[model samples]
Target: MTKQDALFQYCLRLGDDALILGHRLAELCSRGPFLEEDLAQTNIALDLTGRAQLYFQYAADLEGRGQTADGLVYRRPERQIYNHLLCEQPNTDFAYVIARQLLFSAFDRFLLEDLCTSKDERLVEIAAKALKETRYHLAHASDWVYRLGLGTGESHRRMQQALNDLWPYTGELFEIDDVGLHLLEAGIAADLHTIRALWTPEIRQMLQKAGFEQPADDYMHTGGLKGIHSEHLGHMLSEMQYLVRAYPEATW
Candidate 1:
């Protein structure tokens, strides 16, 4: 693929991660365990959506095919999306939500920091903006991981179980292919290999502080980078796309 195509794909990957996870968190609005948690989640969802717009806008300009960010976000089928599998997974429960956030946010925080130094001016600005939000996301989720992990037996077990189930998907966040290498070579992307060194240790420390043991499962679930995802993404697409599908260009 050409350099432009590769960079566009890279932006889509970043946009998809923010969009999918933002929507996932938005689902907790008014459905959280408490009012404060609900507001917190909703706020973070807004932050993520904003970050997604930046990436999607850049991707559209890079593609230069007259595709707007809205078109890319609302018009694509689930199979065309390149979000990580972890972001597409269902919230399931509160413990599951925090577990997913903790793992992904921890990785995101570090990755964005590395990206802040990227040679690409637009990407560096976006990464710098995103890193600010991701740091808080990591902190909040980590607190809950500790709270639930050290609480009563039932809460502790649930948190541990969520970690075990979600751990498999975490590996996908670090899988760099030729597209990644292309960006890296151009100084438009950070080396995830180096990021992984930091991510792994921080995650280990977080889990230990929460009193949760890391699962021994060697099989790491992947494939979302190639547009292959779990069923949850399809359902999410249906809801997210309904308005766009019904109204081609509705503007209020």
Candidate 2:
């Protein structure tokens, strides 16, 4: 693929990740464990959704196909999306939510930092803005990891279970494919391998502080980058696209 194609796909993947995770977080709008946290979570969801729009607008511009951000988001098939698998995982519980956020935000924090130095000016700007939000997201998740992991016997157990269940999905975040390789060669993409190095130690440190063991990274799930996703994404799309699908020609 040409550099433009690779960049387009890259933006789409980033946008997809934000959109799905934002939606997942939105599901917790009024269901947070407490009032302050409920508002915090909703704000984070908005941050992610707004980020998705930026990335999608860039992608649409790159594609030059007259597609709007809303069209790309609401009209695409599930298999056409390129979000990471971890973002699509369900919020089974509060512990599960924190664990998932911990994994994703930790990596995203470093990834966006790396992106801030990318050769592409647009990517650099997007990354710079996103890194600020991701820093807060990482802080929030890391705090919860400690709170839930060290809270009580049941909370600790649930936190550990969530970590174990989600660990397998983490590998895909660092898996570089052809598009990524091309972008890397052009200096337009962040080096995930380098980000992985930074991500591991911080995650380990947080887990250590929480009196929790790190899950083994032996066999990880994959395929999200290639538009392959878990069953949850389709169901999410069904709900997320309901209005758009029902009124394709309606303008508001």
Compare the candidates by lDDT and give the number of the best one. Answer: 2
Give residue 243's error in model 1 in angstroms.
Answer: 1.4
* C-alpha lDDT score of every prediction, in listed order: 0.91, 0.93
Models, CA RMSD each: 1.1, 0.9
Per-candidate count of clashing residue pairs (backbone under 3 Å): 0, 0
- Candidate 1 local lDDT, residue 107: 90
**Candidate 2 segments whose C-alpha is farther than 4 A from its true place:** none
TM-scores, all candidates, are 0.97, 0.98
Clashes of 1: 0
**Model 2 RMSD in angstroms:** 0.9
Lowest summed lDDT window (length 10), candidate 1:
243-252
| Tens-digit lDDT track of model 2 for 40-61 | 9998899999999999999999
Off by over 4 Å in 1: none
Q: Per-residue lDDT for 102-171 in model 1, tens only?
A: 9999999988998998888989999999999999998899889989988889999998888899999988
